[model samples]
Target chain A: MLAHYGYKDGSGDYFIIIDTDKCDGCGKCVEACAYGVMELIEDEFDIEDGSMAAVTEEHRKKIKYSCGPCKPISGERKLPCVLACSPKAISHSW
Target chain B: MITAGVDVGAKYVKVVLLEDGRKVLKRANGIVGFDILKSATEVFEKALLEAGLNHDRISRVTATGMGRKAIHKKHPLNAGEIVPEVIADAKGAYHLLPAVKTIIDVGAEEGRGVKVGEGGKVKDFVINERCAAGAGTFIETMARALEVGVEDMGPLALKATKAIPMNAQCCVFAESEVVTLIHSKVTKEDISKAIHDAMAGRIASMVLRIGVEKEVVLIGGVARNPGFLPPLKKELNTEITIPEHPQYVGAFGASLLAFETEGK
Candidate 1:
C-alpha cells in the first residue's frame, strides 16, 4: 500500500509518499525526521505483520509548513527523511 | 542607508532598524494578537520613531517569521522581500558571533536547530515536529498552571533543590502531569526545572540530528530563560552563546538581508 500524506496549497502539491511494500519499518525515517512528521504505526496489510512509518495525522493538513524547514525554497531535493529510508520507500511531491 | 526588518512571531512581533547595514538604530517589540499586520506595522513604526527616522528613510524592508506573508500582503509597498526565519536567524547569529556553528531557536509555536556552514549560511536545519511541547508555549502553560509569572520561571527554577522528571511527551499530556505534580506537593521550582529539562531534551534530540558543533548559539524567546539554558547546555554537553537581544535575531537578520539585496 502506498500511503500519501499532505495537501496542495497555494504554492503547489506537497506530499510525503511512502511505499509500504518497500518499507521494512526500520524506523530510520522516524528517527531522521526532526519535525516529527513521521511516526511508527502498525501496518494493517503487512504480510510479515510489522510496524511501518507514516506521517502523523496532525501534520497532514500542514505538511507544507511542517516540512518547510527541511525543504529549501530553492535548490535540489535532499530530504533527510527520504535519504534515511534505506529501502528508498519514501518520496516527496513538491 | 537605513533598512528595516520585521519579524512577526506567533507571540511577539519584533522590528529592527539598521543603519548602513551595521549599527542597530532602534528595535521594538509588540505582542501579536488578532491583528498580526497591525502589530508588525506598530513595531516597525515604533522602531523608526525611536531612531528619529521616517518611513521614507528606510531604503528597504524585509519581513520574516510565520506571519511574513500577511505583512507582505498588506504592506506590499513597505515590505520589499520576505525570508524564512531559519535563514534570518542564521544570518543574525553569525553576524553577532562569527564562530557560531550551531543555532538553537525556541519560539512560541516552534523550535529550530540550524547548522551554519561557511559564510554563515544555513547548511542544514531541523524544526520541532508537530507538537508545542518543546517550544516556549509549553513553558508558558506550565508557568500559568503553577501561578507563577512566565518571566520568573527561569530564576525560580534555578532554586530547585531536587530534579523531578516529567514523563509526558506531549504538551497536552504534560499539562495533566503538571497538575498531578502540583497535587503531589511538588514545589513549583522543581516542577519548573523538570519542564525546562524535558523541553531541553526534545531540543537536544533535534540538534543531535545535524550534529552539535562548537560555539552553539541559542536564540529566540526561550533563550531568555535562565533555567532552560542550563539544561539545554547540559543536554547537549556544550557551552551555549546567547546574543544581547536573542529574541530579535530573526528581525536583525532580515534587516541585514534587506541591506544586502536592496536595489539588486
Candidate 2:
C-alpha cells in the first residue's frame, strides 16, 4: 500500500510517499527527522504485522512547509528521512 | 555599538534594540497583517524611535522568523543577515538563563523543542509547525469559541473543577469538540484546561524526542499564558524558566548576533 502524507494546494502537490508494503517500521526515519515530521504507528493495513512508519498526522496538511528545511531548493539531495529508511520505502513528490 | 534584531513571526513582528549587545535599549511588537514588510519595518522603526536613535545609529540589523526572507529581500541594505527562528530562540533563551540547556517555544503557528549545547549552539531540535492543535492558534480559536478573552484563559482554567480530556487531534475537529462541550453544559474553565492540557501533551511529546535537559526555558508569546505553563511543566515533570519579555527572546537573540557579527 502506498501511504501518502501531505496535500495538494494551489501551488503544487507536496507529498511524502511511503510504501507501507516495504516499510519494516524500524523507526530509523523517525529518529532522522529533526522536525517531528514522521512517527511510528500501528499498521492498520497490516494489523497482524505489528507497526509501520508513517508521516505524523499533524504534518500531513502542511508537508511543504514542514519539510521545507530539509528539502533542497534546487538540486536533488537525498532527504535524511529517506536515506535513513534502509528499505527505500520513502520518496517525495515536490 | 547599537544593533537591532527583527523577528517577523507568523502573527506578530517583534523588534529589539540593544546597546553594545549587553543591554536592551528598546523593544516593540506589532501585529502582522496583510503586509508583512510594512509591519516589520514599522516595528523596527518604532524600537529605534523609542530608544531615541536613528537608522544611522544602528551598526547592524539581523532578521529572523517566518517572514525573515521577505525582510531580507526588501531591505537588503538595512537587514544585514537572517537567522533561523530556532537558533534565535535558543540564543535568546540561553542569554536570559545561562544554565538553560533546553528551549521550548510555542508560537502562533508552531511549537519547537530545541536542545542547546555549550555556547548556546543548537545540538538538536524538533519543530511542530504542521499542526495548529499544538500551537497558540488552537488556544485562540478555542477561547473565541468559549467567548472568553485570550488573556483571561489562564486564570479561568486555573479554576477548572474537573478534568475533561480533549481527544480531537486536529484544530477543526477540536473546534467542533468545543462546541459539543459547550452544548453539554461543561464549564468553560474545564474546557479551557482540557484544551491547554491537550496542547501540553503534544508539546511534551516533541520535547521528549529532543530529551529535555535541566534548566528548560519556555519562550515565545504563548509562554505568557499561565494555563499552558502548569500543565506543560507537569507534562514534562520539570521546572521551566520564563524570562522577562518572553515573546521578544528571538529578536533579542538576533540583536546579540548582529552585535557579534559586526564585531567579527
Candidate 3:
C-alpha cells in the first residue's frame, strides 16, 4: 500500500495503461492523483447491465501527464486511480 | 557614496537609490514608452526627489532589466553600460539576505531564479520570460476567475477547501479551466491553491534541476500573493525568505550595483 502511493520506478519513469473497452471515460482517474498526470479523453465502453454507453463531449477519457506516462497499474495491486475511480471505467493490467 | 539603480521592466519601472548599501528610497510604477531611456530618467528623477537627493548627488547610475540597455544610454558610465537584470537582482539579494542561496523573482511577464555561492557570486540561474504561467499573470487570471481583485487573492485563497487540480499548461487554457471549475462549484481556495500548486510544481522542478541551496528567497510582485508562499514552501521542502518590499529587489540590486561601481 505504501508503494502504491509512492512511485516505484525512478521519478518520471512509470507509465499508466488504460483499457479502452473497460474505460467509461470518466475523470476519476485524474482526480485521484495530485500530479495532473491523467486526462479525460472521449471514448465508449459497454456497461455490465447489457447497455452500450457512448462518451460524448460531456464525457472524456483520462490521459496522463503530457511530459510523461503514469505509473503501471497491475492486477494484485491495481492503479490507485482505478481503485479510487467511482465510474468503474478502469482496471489494472491483469 | 550615493548611487542609484533603475530597472525598467516590461510592466513596471523600478528605481532604487542606495547610500553605502543602505537603501535610501525605492519606487515602482507600471509605465512604458517608445523611448525607454526617457521614461527611466523621469522615474529616476522622481525617485531621487522622494529620497531627498538630486541627479548630481547620485555618484553613479546603473541600469538593469529588459530595458537596461536603453536606460544605459541615458547614463554616461562606461563600466555600468551593460548588466543583466538578473545579475543585478542577485547582487541586491546578496546584500539584503546575505545567507540566501536560492532566489525566485516573479515579474509581470517573466520569472527569474538565481543560485548564489557563499561569496556573493552567482553560481547558476534560470529565467522564464516567455511563459505567462511563470509570471504574475497566472494569479491575475485566477483573480478574474474568482471575481476578486488581484490584491485580495492572498487572503481569499486561505479560505478555500481541497485544491481542484488546474491542468491547463498555458495561461489561456488555464483560465478556461478555472471557469469550468468555478461553474462546477469548486471552492475558491481549491482553485487558488491549484493554481499556486501548478506553478509551484513548475518552479520546484526548475529549482531542483538547478540544484538549489539552502535559504531560498522569493521576490517580485507575485511574491505578495499570500497563498503562494505556503504551498511553494511545502512543495519545495525549503524555507523561503521574502522581504517586506519583495517587488523592489531588482531595483535594489541595480542600486547596489551603482553603489559598488561608484566606490571603485
- In terms of TM-score, the best-performing candidate is 2
Error of 2 at B149 (Å): 1.3
User: In model 3, how large is the Cα lDDT of residue A14?
Assistant: 23
lDDT of 2 by residue, B49-71 (tens): 78889889899999999989887
* Candidate 2: Cα lDDT at A13: 81
- TM match of model 2 to true structure: 0.76
lDDT leader? 2
Candidate 2 chain B: minimum summed lDDT over ten consecutive residues — where? Answer: B69-78
Evaluated against the true structure, the overall lDDT of model 3 is 0.67
Model 3 per-residue lDDT at B222: 81
Off by over 4 Å in 1: A1-94
* Residue lDDT tens for model 1, B1-264: 988889988889999999889999998999997977877888788887788887898999999998898888466336978999999999999999999999999999888989999889999987764467768999998888888999999998899999988877667778899999999999988999998988888788767767789999999999999999999989889999999999999999999999999846
Better of 2 and 3 by DockQ: 2
